[model samples]
Target: MKDSPSRPLYLAPYYIWIALFVIAPIALIFYFSFLDLTGAFTLENYQNFFSSVYLRMTLSSFWYAFLITLITILIAYPTAYWLTKTKHKQLWLLLIIIPSWINLLLKAYAFIGIFGLYGPANKLLQALGAGPLQILFTDFSFIFVSVYIFIPFMVLPIFNSLDKINPALIDASRDLGASSFTTFRRIIFPLAINGVKSGVQAVFIPALSLFVITRLIAGNKVITLGTAIEQQFLVTQNWGMGSTIAVFLILFMIIIMMLTGQKEKGGLYNGKTK
Candidate 1:
């Protein structure tokens, strides 16, 4: 039998946009990564980036972003489940999404007001008879600000996934002698993994390149690949080296995406449907 027509109207525009925007930019970046300061082909920039401190900074950025992704998934799961089941789900969603509309630079500055040496957080600790705290401009501040800024990104995908689930499924699991925890573990979590994967990708990519928040919150003591890239472009004007670092970051993201894709495919083949 001949197949019915698919959604060409929807698919055509999307494919064209993807080709023009996503595919084209990635190709340009890959090409630029191999170009030298004089616009000649060279691998020296890539070699320098992988040599010593730059390599460590790049790996550290990815590592910390990974840590934040793990934490966001753990934190978001329960909140998403709760909101999905709650009566005021729309209101909860609005609360989650509102922060995202705020300017990211403004949000980073706000953290400075909270964690700066004389900021409210430190003042509160001092009032409680604790010693002067040095939190801002540290690794902890980097993690804290990055996670806070990205929490909504993590929450929304998970909430959408959880909401797609039928309440009847949970009830059926309970009826079949599964405790609430058992139902969650065996049924809910498996179904939610796709959303979790999306949330991880959303948070990790931005967090990996977060230089403004790192500068404001971490006081320049903490360095990431993003900061290095900024320094390379603005201070040293080393486009080749910066582009090489950018390529490595892209490769790292691809590796993570591949691993996540495998997990998703494996889960699907094992009869776990989202």
Candidate 2:
């Protein structure tokens, strides 16, 4: 059917918002990335970014983010699989999502209490005759908090995908003498790739950009590109350098999405869980 000209009008507000908030900001970043400290056109921002210190920090941030995403997927996929089998799955999912609604700073504070010197974790250690372990301001604490924070983002999509799989197909596979592992490996996992991709993307993008949790949990011990960007803009007052980092991050996100996303049979990005 031919679309009405007014169909475009229906999306006018969305287009306007996108232009103002998204395109305009990106264009400004592009402009900033090319400018020097004196506002002259230069590649100095990119040059400084590729320097050894910045490059090493950037790679470390990527590694940390990747580990956090990996751990979330490992835990979330099994939890989601079990959720699909439960009678009260909706309630379970609600419980999983409830914590996410809490303020992120609040969650960080809560972890502070739990991981503090005289906190419950150490108290338990003392009771067990083990010395109180220092956890605060460490890489372990940072990764722990990150995985805690992002696991829900991984769970929902995988649950949706698993929930949509046909029980009849499973039954038939079993009838045909396929083992449980074989059935899942052959029939289930491949069908759910899109959901897995969605979950990973949801977890990875924010984790890559994470700054506050690192500061709160790892102090200066953990530094991400996000922290570097903040340092450039807020402390160093280097807008050009900050914008350069932001552009690189945007490119990194695009690369990750392209690498992880699957093509649907129709030649589009496969995002629908079912």
Candidate 3:
């Protein structure tokens, strides 16, 4: 095998894009992480990151991301499984995904009205003889909105994985006296685990870094790593500390991807066997 002279030409745009957008930004962040407010090079930023305040923020961020991801998975798996059995599934799936095309800010604002004190949600609660509860600007509101936003992302991957399953295997399992639950547990779930992994990867990473939903929905009651980063860079004008947080965030993102990403040569059905 020899090199193709045209290969470099073909890959030039991709490499250039990565260098400019991905590599360059990461390099800049890494460089800035060691500098202080006065542009003096120091490790103080990293030192602050290890302190109790930051450690608590990091734990809280993880806890919130975990809850959002878990709720998304619980809802999405059932929705996707149902979609797989539908006649016009693609249409329904498209409907589910269309909301994601709308601007996130717009959606957040829409929820603000929906969950307002005198809004439909509270009105319904009042109709049921229950007093209007404060729904907006609460952890419940934040997690609910976040889960709603991420459901489509989670469903699409699981839907795709479920769709790829061979129909005959399911039929054989049923014919061989296996119950629906057993067949699903033994066959369908195993084959679809990769999609679950992909869905988790898609939902968890963004959930970890979400600031807008926290601001609009949670009303500063919940603060994640993203909120801290925004406060550092924009509010306090501390780019060094912000970049240090970003560098660590990037590291966490990498570690998660490594854990959830599938290998090319393995899985229950990559068409290869040992």
TM-score for model 1?
0.83
lDDT per prediction?
A: 0.78, 0.86, 0.89
Which candidate number has the best lDDT? 3
Q: What is the lDDT of residue 99 in candidate 2?
A: 77
| lDDT (10s digit) by residue, model 1, range 152-174 | 88788788778888889998999
Instruction: Quote the lDDT for 2 in model 1.
Output: 42
Listed per model in order, the count of residue pairs whose N, CA or C atoms clash below 3 Å is 1, 0, 0
Better model by TM-score, 1 or 2?
2
Instruction: Point out the higher-scoring one by TM-score: 1 or 3.
Output: 3
lDDT of 2 by residue, 1-274 (tens): 2766556667799999999998999999999999877899999889988999889989999999999999999999999999989999999998987877788899999999999999998899899999999989999999999999988878888887888899999999999999999998998898777778888878787887888898788888998888888888899998999999999999998998787776643212323311
Candidate 1 Cα errors over 4 Å, as ranges: 1-25, 261-274
Cα distance off (Å), candidate 2, residue 157: 0.4
The list of candidate 2 runs beyond 4 A from truth reads: 1-15, 262-274
Checking candidate 3 for backbone clashes, the offending pairs are none
Best of the two (1, 2) by lDDT: 2
- Those runs of model 3 whose alpha carbons end farther than 4 Å from true positions after fitting are 1-16, 264-274
Cα-lDDT of candidate 2:
0.86
